[model samples]
Target: MHGHQIRRAAQVDRTELWSDVKPGSLYGALHRMQVEGVIEAVRTEQEGNRPARTIYALTSAGAAELIDHRDEALRDTKLRHDPVDLALQNVIDLGEDALRAIIVARRKALAEQLDAWLALRELAAPHIRGLEWTTFRHTELRLRTELAWHDELLDQLPKLMANQPTSMTTS
Candidate 1:
């Protein structure tokens, strides 16, 4: 439909899946797609009191490209650039209490993320129906998976701490 609709769809389905699905990236991609003859602007019109909206549709090339990219996306697993992974690799830079604090903070943040997604799912379920409900379901599942992984790390931290040198130990 329009850019807002496109953004709404991406926010639900692709937001957490892709790091670049934010508003800036969405609009930028639309512009690039138009430039590359993948999509065309049909018209812009004001609806009610809102600002004007431009409706875009896929060109023939766009349609073909969409099918190819969608298939490739489904087949490929993209690597994530997670800050937690970076921290895990260099945690020796921190002292014992610092590492413990970091772990605790990370765990809390992950719990909050799970709670937020679950709350969003609850808020969205009544108004959204059919296949749309799966959006919330999928996001909740992803958040839960991440939370579980975080908790697993927390559980292992004590053992990890025990193996570290005295410099890494906290009283």
Candidate 2:
């Protein structure tokens, strides 16, 4: 595919699971991949009034490398770091009202995102394969987990606030 074609295909990728393919970065990424011998320019074609576009095809090495990377990622067991955990660790700095407000806002955002994924899934359900469907499901599951965590934190806020130190002490 050419850069424009690749970018067009990226538009349907709501998951953004691997990498966020931005329009501006597509050409640069294609160039780099071609230079690395993972992809090659197949041919240049012009469609009437349109400018010539170089088509690219992945090399055999690229396919092998992709499989290796995918397998390695699947084998990875380390938890991804989230900045929310850091903020929660220092939750003593925020008052109960402030923490509650943050959690509420977070829940709203997560709910909105979940709604978007559901809409997309519904729209694409007829066209998508099992793996693609699972991508949507995976995102839905994560969003639900985070929303539940927020609800639980809200429920525990009173006890958490009561246990917080009234003043900071020097060591």
Candidate 3:
């Protein structure tokens, strides 16, 4: 249910969803979850004489498992690399002006993400109560922290780009 809700809310496809889970492992995990009674196949519908598509929904047990998994993930210390990091890694190829443009683009994207997170937070607030509020609070804090980090990185880009070697010259 967690995966389905997330995918639906985010409007992303299965291929994109697989990126969040371990590579080459999502199908097996989904199958296991179904077998374990955590998730169940809700329905199947055929499309224009093609094979039927199966839609799954989370059972109560699945929701519990999702919460447990989320808690464990939040506790993990491993640093995850996002697309901005990947772009930064290859910045030299783009030159300073282009790199700055990329940073600007990233800032714009972060702003959009922050707005979406805020809306999601608001939507979640009414449903959450007592200690459950703590989870939403944590999510908001993390989003704020990431936005701040993005701003800081944007501020530092000019100086960093200036320090980068422009070219090699020989006489």
By TM-score, rank the candidates, best first.
Answer: 2, 1, 3
Top-down lDDT ranking: 2, 1, 3
Q: Give the per-residue Cα lDDT of candidate 3 at 85.
A: 70
- Candidate 2 stretches greater than 4 Å from native: 166-170
lDDT of 1 by residue, 129-168 (tens): 7887776777678777887887787778778866755554
lDDT (0 to 1) per candidate: 0.78, 0.86, 0.69
Candidate 3 residue-pair clash tally? 1
Q: Model 2 residue 100 lDDT?
A: 95
Q: Candidate 2 residues 79-124, lDDT tens each?
A: 9899998878777677899989998999999999999989888988
Q: Candidate 3: which pairs clash?
A: 1-58
Number of colliding residue pairs in each model: 0, 0, 1
Q: Output the number of the TM-score-best candidate.
A: 2
Instruction: Name the 10 consecutive residues with the lowest summed lDDT in model 2.
Output: 13-22
> Candidate 1 has what TM-score?
0.71
